[model samples]
Target: MKILHTSDWHLGATFEGIGREEDHKFFLNWLIPFLKEQEIVVLIIAGDLFDQTQPSAEAQRIYYQFLLSVSQKTDVKKVIIVGGNHDSPTRLDAPAELLKLLDVFIVGGISVDGKDFSRYLCSLKNEQNAVELVVAAVPFIHEYRLGVRTSMHNESEIHSLFKEKIQNFYFDLADAAEQIAQDAPIIATGHMACRGSELDDAPQEIHMIGTMGGLPSAIFDSRYSYIALGHIHRAYRVDQSNAYYSGSPIPLSIKESNYPRYVQLISYEKGSKAKTVQKIEVPVLRKILEVKSNLEQIHSILLNISWQTPMPPILAISVQVNSYHSGLDLELKNILKNKFQDASPIIAYIRQIPAKSDNNVLASKEAFSLKELTPEQVFLKMCDTYNEIVDENLLQAFRSLLNEENI
Candidate 1:
């Protein structure tokens, strides 16, 4: 049996307000054929199926359409999807009964009691209807769900408690699987931040995940053949453990533009473990490029850049200025229009970054264009620009506001 592992599709995601509908379409178009060719029997999308909880209608359509197409067109026998931190359990679980008709197992979240272990256990059978492989279809787990917290404890102490709770949860699940399995090999899935995985580079995102953290990989039982993971945007193994993150099929940000995005193909047999693995690269259907330099350098690089995608690439241009010019933005836009008259890259962002010494001198520079950083990071930077000290209570309030919906 050949099982393909992938995660963090982030469907309906946009690059600086420019919709990525075409790129996502192209990826699905590419994926369908690959699955057929590889003759994969099980498909595992570990987490983050959509970029947001409430995805656009178009995104939802694409998702359902792809699922329908794959079921009808491919030789794949099963599809497994779990929830990520960005996913809404209710939204995904709503379609559970309907999707089962197409042989898709969607575990959006743990049960209310967190003891419904049976729902997560998926038994993969062979030609004779004999059980071959068992999967622990775990989803993204939050600290609150674990019910481990202490107001009097230090931060480190609290983390240890959470870690113990999480580890115990896995242990209970594994024990249940072991009792049920006579000979079938068991693998598992998870969507959380682990200690040694490469992370997405946005500062605020980093901070947020850091607080939730880097769960120690040692917590997982070594009994499982393979533990497919998600949440981390980078595809890598956690310090040479049985677990591995398949990462996103497409780069989510400019910082991720250079990542070698691919889904893993793992070889499995009727009675053995998931043996070997192979990476089948997913082509970047479009580009998201960022260039930061003096105007002359920026202009030169943009014109000479290589673009081998079907769609016009999304671009972020940062022009370093010694002195501010009111019309620089207009001038740059005009220049781009003239230069790439035939097919121009989409100018998603254009910001003039003055020298650090010049930050406080001009209001424009003080209110800098935000890119890549989290809202909190940008807010702190703004405070730094005005030389203001924020009290702890004020910072906490700001964080609360940041986490609020529709803000």
Candidate 2:
């Protein structure tokens, strides 16, 4: 049997501020043909089907369209989708009955009863109606969903309790799967952060039902033939040979620009213990180029860009400047305009890099002083630092609050 493993589609995500609808459409269009060519029997999407919990209308359209295509257009028999932390369980589960008729399985989260481990266990059959694969479709296990009541006040105790609950959850589901299809190859799907996995971007705040830190890779029981994981954007293997993260199909952040995006294909026979895994690379629909250099270097790079394709790649330019130049941004914009007159590249962002300064110099009396500024000035300075825009009305509101505080 051949199964395709992919995750973190993050549909409706935006690159910086630019919408990724085109990029996602390209990938989905490409995926249908590939699945047919590979003659895949099952497609597994680990988690994070949509970027946001409440996806936009356009996002819903794209998601449904893809599902329709896969079910009707492709030769693939079955698809399994799990929910991530960003997914709303109720929303993903709303279409459960309808999608089931099309041979698509979705595990949005734990059932309302919370302790029903049987809900996560699913058995897949081939055209002969013989069960060939057993999957424990465990969605993102939040602590609250596990029905564990903890009175422990200590941080360590809370962490330990959460870990135990999660481990037990998986074990229960695996046991259930084993009971139903003991002879078939068992596969488990999960959406959670696992320890020792590499992250493509700088760590962002992740507050979920489980512990703030990731769970150990050893948590996955060795009973399953393969474990498909999601949550982390970068593709990598966990401690065991059978455990792997297929990663996001598209780059979600600038930090992930260089990471290769691919999906995994697994083939296993009825009685064989050994499974063959293949990494199928997804073609880059569009390029996200990040350039950090001096003014001259930036100008050269932009002018030298080969614009052979119809659409130019998005550019994120960061220029190192010793001091502020009045028309520097305008100058750079003009340069790009002159070079790509026919087809202008999308400018994602432009960052100004201030030169390094000595700490002692900054502490000196002559250096820039925040204490000498007024409350409004300080607020405006903060806005500049965070690259936020404050309208006149908002600025007035801040001033009024400051006045009330006598600052």
Candidate 1: misplaced stretches above 4 Å? 150-152, 198-209, 356-371, 378-407
Please provide TM-scores, in order, for all candidate models, with all chains considered together: 0.89, 0.82
Which regions of candidate 2 deviate over 4 angstroms? 147-152, 199-213, 271-273, 306-311, 359-407
lDDT of 1 by residue, 1-407 (tens): 88899998999888778888888889899999999998988899998899888999999999999999989999888899999877888899999999999999999987878988998988877788888777899998765567743333444665788678878888888988877665777779998778775445322332222555687788788877788988777777886888888888887788678777888888976567648877778887877888888888977887676677776778888877776768877777776678787687788878877755534565344334465556777788879879989876566566544533311
| Best by the TM-score measure | 1
Residue 338 lDDT in candidate 1: 82
RMSD of each: 3.3, 8.5
Error of 2 at 14 (Å): 0.9
Candidate 1 displacement at residue 21 in angstroms: 1.2
Per residue, candidate 2 scores C-alpha lDDT tens digits across 208-294 of 322336667667777878899888877777765578888888777665657678898999976664698877788756677887888
